[model samples]
Target: MKKLLLLSISLIISGCASFGEGVTTAFLNKQKEKDLRECRVDGKSFGGMQGNYDGSNNLLKVLMVHGVGTHIPGYSTQFQEKLAAELGLDEMSSHYKEIKLVNKEYPDQDLGVLRVRRLLDQEQDEEMLFYELTWSSITNPQKEKLAYDTSGEYSFRRAEVNQMLKVFSNDTSPDPMIYLGKHSQDVILASFRTAFCWMMGRDWDALPNESQELCTVGQTAVEHLPDEDFAIISHSLGSRIVMDGMKSMASRVSKAQEGEPTSTEAAFITDFQKKRTPFYLMSNQLPLLDEAAIAEKNSASLKFKV
Candidate 1:
C-alpha cells in the first residue's frame, strides 16, 4: 500500500495524461498550501544577480545541474526564460553555445553536453551567461539494462496504472544506483568538472559552439577567475552531485593552496576556491543521499498492524 501510494504520487507529479484531471486538480490544490513547508537556509546571505553584470569587466555566470531522471540539453528552457524576464534581460544572443563535455583520458566516453545562453538587457550592458548541464547521457547506457522490462512485450501483461508506474520506475529508479557505482560516480563528477571548466574558460564570444571537445583550465582561464561570479541551480540528485563535486574540488584546492605551487592547475584550483560560489538547490535530496551510507538500509523491522 505504501509503495502504491508512492507510485500514485509519482504519477501525479509526472502529470501522466491517464490520471483523471479532477483527481489531479484536487490533489494539487491540497498541496498548494498555506505556506506549510518550512525552509531553513543555513549559510551566509547573498545578493541577487539583478545588477551583477558590469559591462565587459565583470560577468555573471550561472550553471544549472539537473536531478534524477532523463534530461536533455534544453531542459531548463522554461526556468531560464522566467529568470531572464525577472532580471529584465530582454535581449539574448541569436544562438546559444553548446559544448560536449569530455575528459582527455576518456576520449570515448560521452560525458554529457553543456548548453550556454547569453542574456542581456536592452542596453546590452548588463549581461548573464546561463549554462545548463545535462549529464543523464552518462548514466543512460547503464539504465538500458532495464529496457526489456519496460518494453511492450513485458509491459502488456501488467495493468495500465502498474505499467505506467513501471515505466516511470524504469526511467528514474536506476540513476542513484548507477551513481553509487565507483566508475560511474567518477565519470559523472568528471562531467561536472568538465562543465565547470568550460564555464570558467570562456565568455560568450570565446566559447565553442556545438563541439565534443574537452575544456582545459589553462593560464588564461585562471586569470579571469576573479572577474567572474558563478552560481549553481540544481534539483534533487543533481544537488548531491553539485555538493560532492564542490567538496572534491575544494579538497584539491586546499591541498594546492598548502603547497603554494605556481603551476596553472594549482593556480586555477586556488583561485576557484575564492569565488565562494553559491548553490541554489531545488527539491534537494542531499540530506538523504549520504555518500558513505547511501546504500545502507535500516536493519530494524517495522512494527505495523497488518
Candidate 2:
C-alpha cells in the first residue's frame, strides 16, 4: 500500500500534463504575469565552471546524471551546448567518446553508458570535459513489468489523457521503487562510480572510444586528482545517487584509513579533501527518498569533505 502511494505520487510529480497543467491552466494563466517562479537556493554558494578553467592545464570536468526516465547518450547535447556557450567555450569535438559501463564482477549486468565530449574556448586556452551518464537502463528491466499495459491491447481501452498518464507512470514511477530493492541501487551506484573514475582519471584523448569497459580508481586518477576539477549536474533521482555514491566512497576511504591505507587510496583521499566538487541538482529529490544507512556518524560530512 505504501509502495502504491509512492508510485501514485511519483506519477503526479513526474510531469503528467493532464494532472498538472490541465487543472492549473486557468489559474496559472490568470496569475502567470504576477506569479514569481523564484529559484531559491539554500546552501553555500561556490563559483561555478567559470573558475574551473583557469588556463592552468587543469581540466574542468562536469558529469550529467539524469533522474528517473529512459535517456539516450545524446540527451545532454542541447544542455551541453548552452553550458559551453555560457562558459565561452565555442569549440567542441566532432565526436564523443562512448563507454558501455559494465562491472567486471557482474559482466552480464547492463550498468548503462558514459558519453564524453570535449569543449574548448575559441583560443583553445581553456577546456572542459562534459560527461553524460545515462543510467536509466539499470532500472529499465524492472519497469518492463508495465510494458504490456502500454501495448495497444490494453492502452486502446483507456481515455487518451489516461493513457498518457499511464505511460508516464510506467516509465518513471518504478525507478525509485527499484532502487529500493536488493541490488538495483548497487548497480546504479556502480554506474555512477565508474563514471566518476573516468572523469577524474583521464583527459579526452585517454578515454576509450566506443568500447565496453569498467573503470577503477587507478594510478592515473591518483596522479590527476590534484590538478583536475570535477563537478556534477544531476536531476531528480540522480541527486540521491550522487549523495549515496559519495557516502559509499567515503566509507571505503574511511575503512582504508582505519588500518593501513594504500598509496593510491591515500593519494585519492588526500587530494579529494583539497578540492570542492559541487553538485548542481535540478528537481532534486533527496528529501523525498529514504536515506541509506551510514555506519559513520559524520558520513555526510565525510561525503562533502572532499
Candidate 3:
C-alpha cells in the first residue's frame, strides 16, 4: 500500500514542471481546493510578523517534515532541542514555544492538524529558526475507531475521527495507510496546506470557525524570512511528502511567472530557489526511495521565444 502510493504521488509531482498543472497531479489528482491560498484571507495578521521583522537572512531556517505514525506536540519540541544540542547550542529549553495549528487538540474535525514548535536563536550574522512540522494527527490509527455511545454518554465526551471517512459502517475497518492510500487525498493535501500556512507565518490560532477548508485559504504573507536559507528535514516516509510539496511549490512558481506581470507565487518560490532550499532526506527509506525519487526532466521538447 505504502510503496505503490508513494510511487504514484512522486511521479505526478517530480514529473510535472507547471504549477497550474502540477498541483492537481501533485495532489494525486484531487481538485477540491486548487484556488486555496497558503495564508489567511484577512489583512489583520496578513503578512504574519515577517512584514515587520527586518532581520538578516543569515539564519538557518528548517521546516522539519515528519514521516508517518502517531506523534504529538512533544514530538516537535524534542526535535528542535536535539538539533540545537547537536549544533553545540546552549539554553535549549528557553528557546522553545508550543503552538498548534488551530490552538486545540482534535481541532474540530480537520483533515490534518499542524503544530510548530519554533526555536529561535539569532546572533548578528548567525541565526537559526527550526519550525518542526508534525502531521500525525491525520495519519494515525485511532481515526478508525468509531464512537458508539460507550458508557451511554452523549454530552460528556469530545468529538474526534470525523475526517476522511465521515461514516463508519458496521462491517468496515479503517486501513492504517489510509493517509497514503485512497480516501486520503484531502488528508495529505491538508498537511501541505497547513505547512504552507505556517511557512507563510499566519496567525493560525485565529483560524475562523466556519472555515472548513481553511487549508485552501490565501494570504500573500512571507512564507519564509527574507534573505534566509530554507531547508527541509524529512524523516521516514515523510521524505516523499517533502518532495511532493517542493515540486508543487516550484511548479506553482513556474505557472505564476506566466502571468501578465508575474505573480506573488512566482516571486515567493523564486526567492526560495535563490536561497537554494536544501532537502535533508533523513528518512529511513533512502535506499528504497532512491530509484523512484530520481527526478525526471524534459528538456529537449521545449522551444524558446524569439
Per-residue lDDT tens digits of candidate 3, residues 63-170?
777765555555766666676666544433343443445413225644444444333344333345556666666644455354443223542353455322333321
lDDT tens digits by residue: candidate 1, 1-306: 999999999888877655577788988998887877889979866556654654354468899999999999899999999999998889988888988888985789999989999998888777889999999999999888899998889988999999989988998878887887778888899889888888885788888778887677788888888778888999999998998888877786788778867788776776776677778889987766785344433323435476
Task: Candidate 2: list runs displaced more than 4 Å.
Answer: 1-45, 54-58, 291-306
Instruction: Please tell me which model should have the higher TM-score, number 1 or number 3.
Output: 1
Per-model lDDT:
0.83, 0.84, 0.52
lDDT over C-alpha atoms for residue 167 of model 2:
91
Give the least accurate 10-residue stretch of model 2, judged by summed lDDT.
291-300
Q: What range of 10 consecutive residues in model 1 has the weakest lDDT sum? A: 292-301
User: Candidate 1 clashing pairs?
Assistant: none
Sort order, lDDT high to low: 2, 1, 3
Q: Candidate 2 on 129-248: residue-level lDDT in tens? A: 999999998888778888999999998899999999999988988888788765987888888887887888788888878888667888888998887878899999899999989887
Residue 9 CA displacement from its true place in model 2, Å = 42
TM per candidate comes to 0.79, 0.80, 0.51
Q: Which candidate do you rate higher for lDDT, 1 or 3?
A: 1
lDDT of 3 at 166: 32
